[model samples]
Target: MTKLAINGGTPVRDTYLPYGQQWIEDDDIEEVVKALKSDYLTTGPKIKEFEEKFGKYVGVKYAVAISNGTAALHGASFAAGIKEGDEVITTPITFAASANCILYQGGKPVFADIDSSTYNIDPKDIEEKISSKTKAIVPVDFTGQPVNIDEINAIAKKYNLIVIEDGAHSLGAEYKGKRIGSLVDMTTFSFHPVKHITTGEGGMITTNNKELYEKLKLFRTHGITRDKEILYNKNESSWYYEQLELGYNYRITDIQCALGISQLNKIDKFLRRRREIAEKYNEYLKDIDGIVLPYQEEYIKSSWHLYVIQLELEKFKVGRREIFEALQAENIGVNVHYIPVYYHPYYQKLGYKKGLCPNAEKLYERIITIPLYPKMTDKDVKDVVEALDKVLKYYKR
Candidate 1:
């Protein structure tokens, strides 16, 4: 018998290796410390600095910083004019927030199937799901791979619908030689610790349209604007401000923005390291019998966020659960990237049932997100591969 960790044998690693992590250094801390000592903590200079830097990086005209990625999505949904009786189409394979943003605006979420090869929402599926009520398409850049933006854009133009790309995993990704944030009507990003850049818990929406940009700003700050030009009553009074409409307080603090600015400065280096790690994984894992590596489109340059691998279930006697446990038993913190959005209990109660997205539902049964991050050492990458190889070999049919 091949002694295995899951069956009480020696584990491959002494400590657990998490699936994702952040890389923060002295400068990142110093930036936040500077903001902390400054007069403005919440709405301050660092916020604008970060926004401008981010917009320039992504080749966009404006960027609105907010509390978190979900809030970014909600802000975009609001800016897109989603309302009662509206329908938004998105992939079921992404985080629940992708679909939940529609619900936040009193709009119905229409689930779409994914392309099995790329693991992104298929344009064909989006087209099939469209209706007179369909107002927008929220395509997720699943695992840092940019979705087929050109095709999706064509569909949106045909239907006169808005495109809000969920680029939470694709901070530095490019599509057809252009940056992700440069495309579509609006694009949203997350700055969670595990993401490419970390602001602790933050999000942003980038856009080229001035109307959407202004709307996003309003939605981020309780719909209040101090600008004399737009306010109903031209208030030149220094203390005067107006609540133009109903909106949420999704403001991101200067502290987080300070960290974001610092993090953004290092994003290229971080992106390179992430890509190196991903390339290392691909080089070693490609020929592994039971493992199916994630496919990359030739035209899109991926940021390589989550290195998800799908099990060729027929190659192993055991199921995904057994293999997942076996990997965990070896001190590897492997995780599943997502459950189809509609599978959650809340969505289920909303009458979204199973079989809503056959491809995504099928994918959920086989996918596992292994560790890949900028902070990981070469040895850490090797350890992950060795652990996977051992576990899969032991379970081979």
Candidate 2:
């Protein structure tokens, strides 16, 4: 019997399972409470504490705490000397902010096509997109899988371009035995509720460059400096500060940093559970025909922020939307990771047209993100698999 949830058969799960979620424990709550009752909420000791811990974890010499991921990208872009009339090359298969940060600094964002197999920015396509206007490359670690850093770095060096890795989906991910944050000139991370860790809302920028580190700190604080060394005018007053340059108030609070610190403590456990879930999904879904799974290279270790499955649309009676809805009907909270940045209305207003990156456009059509979070129980994983199985059985031609 071909059981079909959409055809009124029993659904696999009674309660909904979200595609991603944060794991909050009593420790997390207590940490937040401690920060709340402390003397400072913003610009407190917790901020530096969190930054130092995260920097150490990523094996980087410096890490800057920012208000959110987008701001982290913005600060990195600003520090990279991205300016008017310059062009930044980045993948189309990413959050709009990955490219938008370039626009924020009055630089143009040039689209680069992705590798068909990895769904990450292709180095060949990146090199092809380079022109005289190109000043930097922002390669996104899509779906927590690390892009080929060595190839990207080589290209960047050949052209004397800065490399800013968008590691939003790849905090704990490793490439060739090293972590994601330290390989590029700058790497950005997010701590959204659904990310590997949660500070409710927060982000980080990690780097080994001392000058970039100093600039990032200044940028996060309205370009002001209280340090006697960096300040232009010598002011002996402890309260005296100077605005060094135009910068935004992109600062993270102590409350969030406390929560982040708590979450960071359990990152290993969270990563292990996420990998376990991904492995199970691989085992269960491997036999499902007309579906293409996420590809992980043997040289890298993915944090598995998202487990996206691509449908072989030609072999399916139902399309991606239909499969998405069918799974939703069975109480699986499936979602799409992104629409190609240039396909959005704002980008269109900026005169970006379709076919900018054919592979990314095609990927946007076929990919569906399913439930793959640490909070999911064994039953939850099974339910998601069973629901997907039912949908595929009914829809596969």
Write one digit per residue (lDDT tens) for candidate 1, span 228-261.
8898888468799999878899999999999999
Off by over 4 Å in 1: none
Over 276-355, each residue of candidate 2 has an lDDT whose tens digit, in order, gives: 99999999999988889899999999999999999999998868989998899899999998899999999999999998
What's each prediction's TM-score? 0.99, 0.98
> Which 10 successive residues of model 1 have the least lDDT summed?
229-238
Candidate 1 local lDDT, residue 1: 55
Candidate lDDT scores, in order, read 0.94, 0.93
Q: What is the lDDT of residue 207 in candidate 1?
A: 94
